[model samples]
Target: MQEATETTHSTAPQLAAPAAESSVRRTVLLAFVIILVALLGVFASRFSVSPRGAASPALLVATQPALAITAALAAMIVSLLIALTLAKPINAVVSLFALGCAFAAYAMQTGTISDFVFLGANFKLAALETIAWSVFIALAAIITFRVGGPLVDVPAHNRDGTFTGEIIHKRALMSLLAAVLAIPVLIFTMIGASKGQAIGACAIAGVLTSVIGRMIAPRAQPILLFAMPALVIGLAQLALAFATTISPDIAFVNATLSPIRVPMPMDIATGSLIGVAIGLGWSKGLVKHEPPSMHDE
Candidate 1:
C-alpha cells in the first residue's frame, strides 16, 4: 500500500504537467493572434510614405532589418533585467511605461506617428515593446500570493469578519494595469515577423524575471531591495555615459535622456535620490504583521 501510494503521488504531478503546458500553449497562441490582428492594421496606414522621406534616406535605409531586430532583442533582455529589479507593482508599471515610451520614441523618430488615429501597434518597434512589457505584467498578476517585507501588508478579514489587516497595496494594482497598458507594446513586438521569436522570448523572460523578482526581491527588501538595484542602475548609467562621451553612437544615444546625462557622480546622485524615494515611500506604508489568529484556507 505504501509503495502504491508513493507511485501514485509521483504520477499525479506528472499527469498535471501536460494540462498546464496545454494551457500555456493556448495562452501564447492567443497572444500571437492578437499580435497578428494589430499588424494587419499597420498596412492600413493612410500615409503615402515616400521612398526618400528624409534627406539622407539612403543612409537611414543602409541599416539592416537585422540590426534593428537585434537591438530590439537586446532591449527585451534589458527590459527583463529592469523588470527583475523592480518591486511588484512598481516593476510591472515601469516596464510598461518604459516600453510605451520607447515605442512612442521610435514612431516619432521614424516619422510614422499618426495623430488622427490611435491604431494599436501600427508603428515599428511596437510589437517587441508590447510583448516584453506585458510579460512581466502577467507574471506579477499570477503571483497573487505576495510575500513582501515586514514593511508591506496584505489585507485580510478577522475571524469575526472584521477588517483585521492593513492593506497598503490594494490601491496599487500594478500587474493588472501594467498588462492592460502593455497591449500596444505587444503589437509592436510582432510587427516584424522576423522578430516574432525574440519578442516571444522576451515575454517569457519577463515572466520568469517577475517570478524570480517576486520571490527574491521581497526577501531582500529590508536590505538590498532599494539600495542594491538603484546602485547597480546608477553604475550602469555611469558606464553608459562614459562610453558614449568617449564614442557616441547616434543610434544608441537616448534623445530624451540627454537632459539627465550621465557620469559616475551624476549617476550616483540620481541613484541615491531614487533610493531615497523608495525608502520614503515604503516607510509611509509601513505596517506590522501579527500572527494569524485563525485560518479558513
Candidate 2:
C-alpha cells in the first residue's frame, strides 16, 4: 500500500507537466481571442456614423482625399506606437488596448470605403477590410515580438555618454542606407513587374528592423519586421482588387480619389516599404545597457 502511494505521488508531477503546458496554451489562445473580439468591435462601430446615410455635396467635399489620408495615417501611427509599447510584457490589459488601437487605425484607413454613401453599394467591404487589416497587423506585431524576443528598454544618452554618439551614428546611418537602398529596389521591382519585390522589401525591412530593434532595446532579438508590412500591403491590394471587380465606380473612388491608394505593384511595394519605414523610424531611440565590466588587477 505504501509503495502504491509513493508511485502515484511520484508520477503526479509528470502528469501535471503536460496539463500545465496545455493550460498555458489555452490561456494564450484565450487572450488572442479576446483581442480579436475587441478589434472586431471597433470595426463594427464605424456604422455609428451611418455609412448608409446620404450626405450633401458640401459634407462630401469636407471629407476630401487629403483629410481622409491624414486621419488614416495618424490612426495607424498611433496604433503602431501603442502596439510596440504594449508588446514587451504581453499583459492582458495592455494587449487589449493595443488591439483596440490597432483596430482604430485600420478603421480610420477604411473610413472612405465605409462612408462612401455616394457609391450607393450595400457591400460591407469596408468593415471587412478594416477587420482583416486589424487582425493581420495585431497578429503580425505579436509574432514579431515573440520572434524578436523580449524588447529591452535602454536609457537615452547624449554625446560623451557611455553610449557614444559614434555608435548611434553608425546604427542610424546603416538603417538609413538600408531604407534608401530599399526604394530603388522597390521601384525597379515594381517597374519590372516582378513578384520578388515582396522578398526584396522584406529583406531590407529585416535588416532595418534589426538595427532599429537593437537601438531601441540594446539586447533586442532579431524579429520578422516585414510580416506586418507585407500583410497590410497585401490586404490593401486584395481590397482594391475586390472593389475593382465588384464595382467600377467604387474602384474609381478608391483608386483615383483616395490618397492612400496606389497602382497595383507600386501600391503593394509602397505600402510595405512605408510600413518598414515606420517600424524603423519609430524604433530609433534609446535602450537599456549592461553595466561596464570591471577589470581587477
Candidate 3:
C-alpha cells in the first residue's frame, strides 16, 4: 500500500506537466487567433471602403457599395467559421472586438475622420452599407449560436430560443435605456486627442455600460448588452455627420462631426467584451446555466 501511494505521488507531477503545457498552448493559440482575426478584419474593412484605390470616403462608398457589402459579409462569415470550429463564443466575440481595435488604431494613425466622412447622396449610401454589414454580421452570429449551440457550449438563455412577451419588453426597455445613457458616457469618455486616450475611453465606456446594463437588467446576458454603448455612439456620430451635410454652415455640426472620438466597431467590441467578462462576474454572469448534453443525459 505504501509503495502504491508513493508511486501515485511520484506520477502526479508528471501528469500535471502536460496539463500545464496544454494550458499554455491554448493561451498562445488564443492570442494568435485574436491577432490574426484583427488583421483580417482590418484588411476586409480597408478593402471594402477602398476597392479601387480611391482616396476619398465619399467616392469610395459611392462607387463601391457592392464590394463594401461583399467584403463585410465575407469577414463576418470568416468570423462565424472561426467561432464555430475553433474558438469559444467568448473568444470569438473577443476576436471580433480585436478587429474593431485594429480599426481604431488605423484611424488614430490617420489622425482624421475624413476616411469615414460621407456627404449628400453618398451619405445615404454609406448608411445603407453600414446597415447591411451590421445586419449580415448579426445574422451570422445568430446562426453560429443556433447551429453550434451544443458544440460551443452556448448559454441556456441563448440556446432556449424562446422569449415571452414580458421578457422581450423588459429587454427592450433596458436596451433603450442603456443606449440613451451610453451616448453621453461614450462621448465624455472618448474625449481625447491621442490613441491611448481613445482606447482608454473605449475601455471606460465599456465597463460603465456593462455596469449600467447589469444594474438595469441583472438577468440579461452580458454579451447582449456589451455592444450597446458602441452602437449608440456610432449612431450618434452618424446622425451628427448627416446633420453636418444638412447644415454645413452650422459650426456646432461641423465641430461635432469628429469620427476620431467616435468608438470604432473594434474598440467598443474589445472594451465591451472584456468589460462584460470581467465586470459582470465571469463564472456566474457569462455562463449562467448550461443545458445538459446528450452524452450526459
For 1-297, candidate 2 gives per-residue lDDT tens digits of 999999999999999999899778756754664455446434433323333342211112222434433443454444444444444444322333344334333333232422343545333333233334434544544444553333344333232343224233433333333333333433444322122333344334434544454553343222223333334444544465466544635554454432222222212322443345344435545444655323100
The per-residue C-alpha lDDT of model 3 at residue 242 equals: 63
Residue 49, candidate 1: Cα error in Å is 4.5
The TM-score that candidate 3 achieves is 0.63
Question: What would you estimate as the lDDT of candidate 2?
Answer: 0.39
Q: Compared with the true structure, what per-residue lDDT tens digits does model 3 show for residues 263-285?
A: 44444444544444344443334
Question: Total backbone clashes of model 2?
Answer: 4
Candidate rank order under TM-score: 3, 2, 1
> Which of candidates 1 and 3 reaches a greater lDDT?
3
Candidate 1, residue 129: how far the Cα is off, in Å: 20
Each candidate: RMSD:
15.5, 12.2, 6.5
Off by over 4 Å in 2: 1-86, 90-173, 191-297
In candidate 3, list every pair of residues with a backbone clash: 100-266, 101-266
Error of 3 at 52 (Å): 12
**Model 1 lDDT tens row, 1-297:** 999999999999999999899778655643443343223222221122323442111111213434444444444334334433333433323323333233222222232212101122111122222233234333332222132213243323233332212222322222112222122322343232122232232233233223333332221122212222223333333444455433322321322222112111112212222322233344333434344434321
lDDT of 3 at 81: 55
TM-score of 2: 0.34
- Using lDDT as the measure, which candidate wins? 3
